[model samples]
Target: MSTRLDDAYQWANSADGPVLVAVEERQDHELAAGSHRHARGQLFGSMRGLLSVGVEEGVWLVPSSHAVWLPPHEAHAGRSHGPFHGWSVYVAEPACADLPRRPCTIRASGLLREAVLRACNWPIDASTAPLAPLAASRGHLAEVVLDEIRTSPPEPLGLPLPSDPRLQRIAKALIDDPADERDLEQWAHWGAVSARTLSRRFVSETGFNFSAWRQRARMMRSLEMLAAGAAVSAVALDLGYSTASAFIQVFRRTFGQTPAAYRVRL
Candidate 1:
């Protein structure tokens, strides 16, 4: 664990070209919220396991084959949904100035991944010959990643954070147990706030009404479960839907496709 933490720190500290540090392994932990507002842009690649990245607007999941590219000084936190392993790429700020200002996950094409690996290990030298090809390749790979993110479907999995501490606790509880049937009144009682206040506070912090937020959360959780190959009936049951058909109805409505079809497509 210490060695891996050291590696993470080193990867963050080393800034030359676009550095790619693959997560060789990881154990489960609640990656606390904070920002590493570096001079360079950061791309978090999670080829295995699930991760969550919180930006100013919302929290996004970084699933396998997906990565989040955070523009410099965007104020964000890196979270792991479970155990995670992948690369962390630190792109030169000048090179990444044009990247997306918000959180996004990019496709990891085979060639692009290799280019990132090469760029990460590039050595600083006086000779400008061998470095030219590496620089060109890194630029190409960054372009590919950006293009993929732009074209990829805007997944229905973002659950925005609640800024208020009380509301934040409620949101965290929902994430902990999506099956919880606690109503606004119950949440208010738990939070020691009035129902009206709870409702208003929830909307004020998350930018979505309670039902809307939960629906989005359910959709995101369902997506994660589907990606893990969970059976539709089981997923529905686990998410507290009365029936699989009911869950499928909501899933299709939100995603514009049936869960089975979506899973097959994925």
Candidate 2:
């Protein structure tokens, strides 16, 4: 963790109240708050940029329209790849027991989005804000956020990295270039394993077969480019899809929206 980035951490760890942090990031700015845990749970989201959160299982690709929920004391590391408008709510375990116990990506609805922003505006530590003097007001706002989080639906935007070094070799190759159109047989060379062995290891370590994981990697990477204002056709071609329409079909099936519609919200 960077020394200068302790403002949020300090606020979150201060006393028993909840915390709200708003980040204004630069395109070149990289925030790598290494793997750490807190007594409280956190809800992380962004209005811009990409969030890569790594837990014991794998990494999650958080887009502008999505949020990630971390249960209390769950070990995780987060990094922002580009300049992003990030916001989060940190509440003690008691305030979030109603939410999911697992670390998962959530599809942020309009109500959940506003509730987080509202919490930001009413930081519990700020003395000058209208509700700054009242601790009850802060607790109430956090409760609202908790309710919304429990109601928010989950999304399949996570990219699960395998634990084995052999699988990591293949995973890294695809992450470096999602357009790599190689099948398991072709990728086996990178991992120094037979094609069948690689396939079995992928399932054992990542809970996904080779083909399914490759598509997930491509889709997760597409979110960053698409959110950064890339055209649908360009993103499709960049991700190795034969055509924009074909890419749109997969994207629509996964997110229930086409690239154009999804980017408009960003």
Candidate 3:
């Protein structure tokens, strides 16, 4: 990690400081922030490039207009797909009582984005005393940012993983090769489990049926490829979609926009 990032991480884990602190970052190369947890809740997003964040339960893909929320002490790691321009907001644990308890992807509203950017301008060591004028102003802005996060709808951008070792193997394979054409029965056989057992285990462990999980895996892969500058049609074919239109339809339904539109935003 760079000195700046190390400092940010240390600040986030500190118990006493600003109630809310925002950091804006721009990196020229892909970067990975390894697994770690902090004492403060966090909201992380990228305004340019794609981000893949992994928590205990699953992995979430955060696109340009979306952000991931991690409650205090949630172990997680992240990787940027390309050059990244983003911001991260860390909130004191006490102030995060009413926030979402689980990691999730939230649709970042314009107001929320601007609020975070504005907060990023304040000095990290700024006074946090309750009666200080600067502190008061910062408090109000923090409340606005928190309210925006609490009210924003979460996006369906997470791909939950199964806990069972058998299911884990299957999920890993699918993730490794989203173009795999294996059916449920075939996967069960390959995993050395009965078809019925595999089906039931998938739903119970991952909260998604085998087919749905595979679809989500493909969608996540598509997002990575798209963000890396692959052609829409090429991405479609590589992910096993029969045609570009079919992939576009699925992408639009899942992300509320076409792949090309998403790439343009990047």
Candidate 4:
């Protein structure tokens, strides 16, 4: 349940500068389910699993292709859909606001990934290093990557936080049981709301249709299993698909990658 600077912070703080840390084989439940912010801007990325970071209002999921940027002192807590190894880049405050303010999933281009790896070993005092020019070059590269991040389109599926208790209850239940066979009409009738009313409210609140939301939910669950190193056939069966081929088709349509490919990248 460590809730302080990540690896970078330890090194930086130890040397009175900056340190980048990479930790593997950790459980999110160990940290509890809450938000905590630090002075260092945080970059949370995992190569082999899904990570969820929640703020007061909404929760953002980091799929394989993306990472989350947390500005300095902006309270947030992270959870994984499955087992994961995380890398954190503890950048200084001056670099914080250059990242996104709200929660977003930014794609990790090859250049961006290399920048992160380089930053991990950044000298505690690069400002005065003999390779000062190299440090400056890395800074410029980071800035360029951040700019591209800002311009890139956010992930296609985002789980919007719902305000209404009625909707929240429904959302939670669905997450708990993705195989729940009830249609929106059945749910609306049970909730004493007409199907049309429920559909409109869902769109207004979550920006996804009832069916679309359910599909995303199912896909998200599958992603977790894949990240956990589950076999494709087993994951598909767990998600209620008739066969692995059906699951693969849906996954390809939604994420543009097969489960195996995504898992391999992770």
> By lDDT, who's the top model here?
3
Q: Is candidate 2 or candidate 3 better by TM-score?
A: 2
By TM-score, the best candidate is 1
Runs off by more than 4 Å, candidate 3: 1-3, 22-37, 45-65, 73-88, 94-102, 108-151, 189-194, 224-230, 252-266
> Please, what are the lDDT tens digits per residue for candidate 2 over residues 1-266?
33324545655554443333432323347667788887678788777656778887776556566788888888999877555567777766665657788888886766777767776665333223421333677567666677777886766647667767787777877777889987788889767889888989889877889898888778877887886678889999999999999999999887789888887764
Off by over 4 Å in 2: 1-4, 18-30, 46-50, 56-59, 80-85, 109-147, 253-266
Candidate 2: residue 8 lDDT (0-100): 53
TM-score of each: 0.75, 0.74, 0.65, 0.62
Per-candidate clash tally = 1, 0, 0, 7
Report model 2's TM-score to 2 decimal places: 0.74
- Report how far off residue 142 is in candidate 4 (Å): 12
Give lDDT tens digits, candidate 1, residues 172-257: 67776778988889988997778898788778777788878877777777876876789999999998899999999999998799
Cα deviation at 155, candidate 3, in Å, is: 2.7
- As a TM-score, model 1 comes out at 0.75
lDDT per residue for candidate 4 within 1-266, as digits (tens), equals: 24332433453223224222322335543233466776666666776555556765565545555667666677788665555555666555554454566555666655666666665554444234222234456667556655655575655434664546777667767766777889898888776777887788888877888888888888877876776678999988887889999999999999898888887765
Output the worst ten-in-a-row residue range by lDDT, candidate 1: 124-133
Off by over 4 Å in 1: 1-8, 11-14, 17-19, 45-52, 58-66, 81-87, 94-98, 106-157
- Using TM-score as the measure, name the better of candidate 1 and candidate 4: 1
lDDT of 3 by residue, 1-266 (tens): 45555556666887667678788898898778889999999999887656768788665555566789999999998887667789999888887999998888876776888899999887754334432234677889988999987888766655666768888788878776889999999999999999999999888877889998899788877876876678999999999999999999999998799998887765
Error of 4 at 156 (Å): 5.2
